[model samples]
Target: MEAEIITIGDELLIGQTVDTNSAYLGQKLGSIGISVSRKTAIRDNESAILQAIAESQSRCNILIITGGLGPTKDDITKKTLCKYFNCGMRRDLTVIDHLEKIFAERGRQLLETNLVQADLPETCITLQNNVGTAPGMWFDQNNKILISLPGVPVEVYHLIEESILPKLQETLQLPIVEHRTLVTLQKAESLLSKDLEEFENTLPKSLSLAYLPNFNMVKLRLSQKANVASDLIIDEYFDKLIATIHDDVFCLGDKDPATHLSEHLIREGITFTTAESCTGGFIANRLMQTPGISSVFPGSIVCYSNDVKISELGVDPNIIETYGAVSEPCALAMANGVREKFNTQLSIATTGIAGPDGGTKEKPVGLVYIAVSTESQSICKKFRLFGNREQIIQRSSNAAIWMAKQVLTIPL
Candidate 1:
């Protein structure tokens, strides 16, 4: 089945708030074999909302809309929906009761405006909102489904998961969909595509492959939608594909790069620390973002200034003077110093000129040096990255983590 998402709000159009709801819905729909054909973001004006709805209904079998469902007058989605369905607005007693109970329990007085939450289109089915006051509405017209949900993320998620998804599955018998993702590092997308050209061409008609690429890593996702049991065939193809990319493949399954690195460090009982300059603690922040990372990741230091690098990471002043703070020598010193200071089994370090400024003749902007240190050895390398300040910082941090992961894989 195909669906279109319409995310409505002045905030989204004005760039005040991001439309993350559509992305979440699209991914969930894709996993269930429902392709999201189009996504639109519009202001809360009636004309724009009507136009979006009409366009979506004309092109897709299902239309999912979120936003503009507040109790205030500016929230005109309910009124607009009533007009679109050619129906009158009626007060839903169940919704009113729920709203009253929630407000009473919280010791808040209900105002006239709050009563507007109970109004719904007469032609639609009201889906109970267990978590909020705005109930979801489902409309069926000409064998197409239209669902209107609250703008709040939590409310929309619960309605979709608890009510809408089950109803959709029952109404439409969908094919069994399965997907497997393989993660690899240190390879560009173009190079990987060239290497896998023949493998992709030989794939069965029932299966589809996509390459999702990011900094320093690529995810190979294989998807199949069919009624028959095709695990054996898919596995045979994936096994051959993995064999061709064995040297670069980092992990199997749909985990991120940090998850793989964290698992490896935890499994090997290796403690880790980072000393960052240009990356500005991004590497440490990413590692900390994953759960159970504290078991392996102790902490990190942001040594942005040359004085701090010399003092905190114990980099020699002479090395800084001779090779500069962004050089390989300083990077190696930072890695080894942090490993010793934290008594960690391994450590990573990054120093670079992430720029729109701070470029010299020899050391231009985006000149980064990354180092990884183990008990026995410390390795450092330089890179002339390309991008703005934030991108340069992000790329440098990813490169440092990738190096650390690579070093950890070496047999001691």
Candidate 2:
């Protein structure tokens, strides 16, 4: 089934708040074989809401909306829905009773304004929100289903899982959509695509391929429509495709790079530390972002200045004078020093000239060296990334992580 998501908020339009609801809803719907055709974010104005709903209903069978549902006066979604559906509001006594009980249990006074939440469009089906004050509303008009959910992420997620998805499954007959993502590093998107040209061309008619490139890696997503019970065919095709790009592949699931690295390190019981320069603490931050990562990530040292590199990571002054800070020798020294200082199983280091300036004839901008030190050996590689400061730093960080993964002897 095709779907459209509308996120309604003045904050979203003004960049005061990010509309993360659409992305989450899209992923959830896609898992159930529903494709999200478009996602729109509108202001709190009723005209904008009406236009968005009308546009969505014309093209999609399912329309999911979030935001403008609150006890405050700025929340006008209920009134707009009533006007659009040509139905008057009716106070749902069951909802009012539940709201009152919740307020009593929470030891809070219920104002008449809060009672307004129990009033919903007469023609719509009122779905009880067990976790919050705002009730979810479901409406079916001319074969189109429009579901209005609270702006609160947790509450909306509960309603989707508890009510919307189950009802959708019973209402719609959906085709099976299978997707597989392969993550790889050490290659550009253009080069990888050229290398896989013949293999991509030979794919069956039902299968489609997409390249999602980011930082130092490219994600190849393979999607197919299942005509019957064709799991074996899909698996076989995926296996052959993986084998075709075996040398470049680093991960086999839909996980980000940090998660893949964290899982690998945890499996091996290997602890890691980092010494960073141009990448700052981005590598360390990403590694620690995952839960249960403290067991694998020991610590990180950010030496932005030459003096700090000498004092903190113990890089030699002579080495910096001779090979420069962004050189392979400096990167290797940083990696070895961090591993020894932290006494960790492995270490990753990055030193780069990430800049809009600071390019010399000898060393141009985007010159980076990443090193990985393990018990067996220390490996360093150089790269000339092309981008602004942010891009350069991100590319250097990604390269360092990839090198760390490689040095640890983690299976791709």
Find the 10 residues in a row with the least total lDDT in model 2: 226-235
Question: How well is each residue in 286-317 modelled by candidate 2, as lDDT tens digits?
Answer: 88887888887778899889998899888999
Q: How much is the lDDT of residue 72 in candidate 2?
A: 90
Q: If candidate 1 were superposed on the true structure by all CA atoms, what would the RMSD be?
A: 2.2
Task: Write model 1 residue lDDT over 96-176, tens digit each, in one string.
Answer: 899999999989998878888888999999999999989999999899899999988989889989999889888888777
Q: Which residue runs of candidate 2 sit more than 4 Å off their true CA positions?
A: 97-107, 230-232
The candidate scoring highest on lDDT is: 2
